[model samples]
Target: MPKIQKRKIIIAKLIVILILLTIFAFSCDSKKPSSRGIRISETKTYEASLYRQNCAVCHGAEAYGKEVDGKQVPSLRFGEIEKKTDQEIYEQIAFGKNLMPSFKGQLTDEDIWRLVRFIRRDLQGKQQ
Candidate 1:
């Protein structure tokens, strides 16, 4: 093969390799866990939005429940939530209790699960 033709082929191979490497890097990054241990692609943005819109009023924006009258509304943070199992939390979210409303028809199972995850992992900082 001519020297110039060989050089061109080598350059084309290098370009292909570089492109593949770039794609591999990005693909790996997409699977990386965020500081909260959730995948970068699986961020709690949607769940957080759901919490803000649905539960934040009673639970407070930070998952710390607000008081009504002279009673404490209860906080979803660490110590307060540590008493309940994930299943219990799921049931509560699905069924509702007292002033809290049921999210069964409004939110899907997956959405509720995501909220549970956000509350447990992100808000309460529980390790899985």
Candidate 2:
């Protein structure tokens, strides 16, 4: 091959390789930082919005609890919540307890379960 033609082919190959490398680097960059990492799934995001709109008023923003009608609403972050099984939490939310009102008709069973999971996992930091 002519020297100039040979040089042109080499440069083209190098450019192609660089382009591939750039693509690979960007593909591997998908991992987010650990601190900012955990993405709330669509379900969890919906559940969170549900909690905030419906439950957060009494449970407080973080389920830290708030007062209602001279009564102190219990915090889901506390020891009592930890002791409660998922079923119990689900029932409480569905049927209501103390000042808490029933959500049975308003919220579906699945949504109640989502809230239970949110409380246990997100608020209480429990794995399950």
Candidate 3:
């Protein structure tokens, strides 16, 4: 083959490889693990947003808890949160206690459940 033709063939092969690589990259599942190290599902995504809007104020952005006044606000990071079952946590969120306010009317059952999952799986890193 002529020098020009060889150069053209090499360039074409390079272009083909680039195209295949781009397709593979795009085709690969984009569902990445979140900053919390949990794989974010649709429900989890919504739950995370809810947590930020509703719960983050007292719970801290990472659900690690914050101190208010002279008292330490309870953290959802670990310990007690991990010990509680899904239903128990749901009740706490729905009914409220002490400083925490009830979310009974504000959040639906599904939203609460997703919140529980997010707290357990994402914040606490507990396996469901």
The top-ranked prediction according to lDDT is 3
Worst 10 residues of 1 by lDDT: 34-43
Worst 10 residues of 3 by lDDT: 34-43
Q: CA lDDT, every prediction? A: 0.77, 0.77, 0.79
Error of 1 at 96 (Å): 0.8
Q: For model 2, what is the alpha-carbon lDDT of residue 123?
A: 65
Preferred candidate (lDDT higher): 1 or 3: 3
* TM-score, cand. 1: 0.61
Candidate 2 residue-wise lDDT, 1-128, digit = tens: 89999999999999999999999997778454222212232235877888877887887766677888788888877668778888989989999887689999999999999888877776666787
Tell me which residue pairs clash in candidate 2: none
TM-scores of all predicted structures? 0.61, 0.64, 0.63
Rank order (by TM-score, best first): 2, 3, 1
Point out where model 1 deviates above 4 Å: 1-44
Residues 1-128, candidate 3: write the lDDT tens digits: 89999999999999999999988986785664444534333434777898888887787766667887766777787657767888999999999987778999999988988888888877777788
- TM-score of candidate 3 on Cα atoms, chains taken together: 0.63
In model 3, how many backbone clashes occur? 0
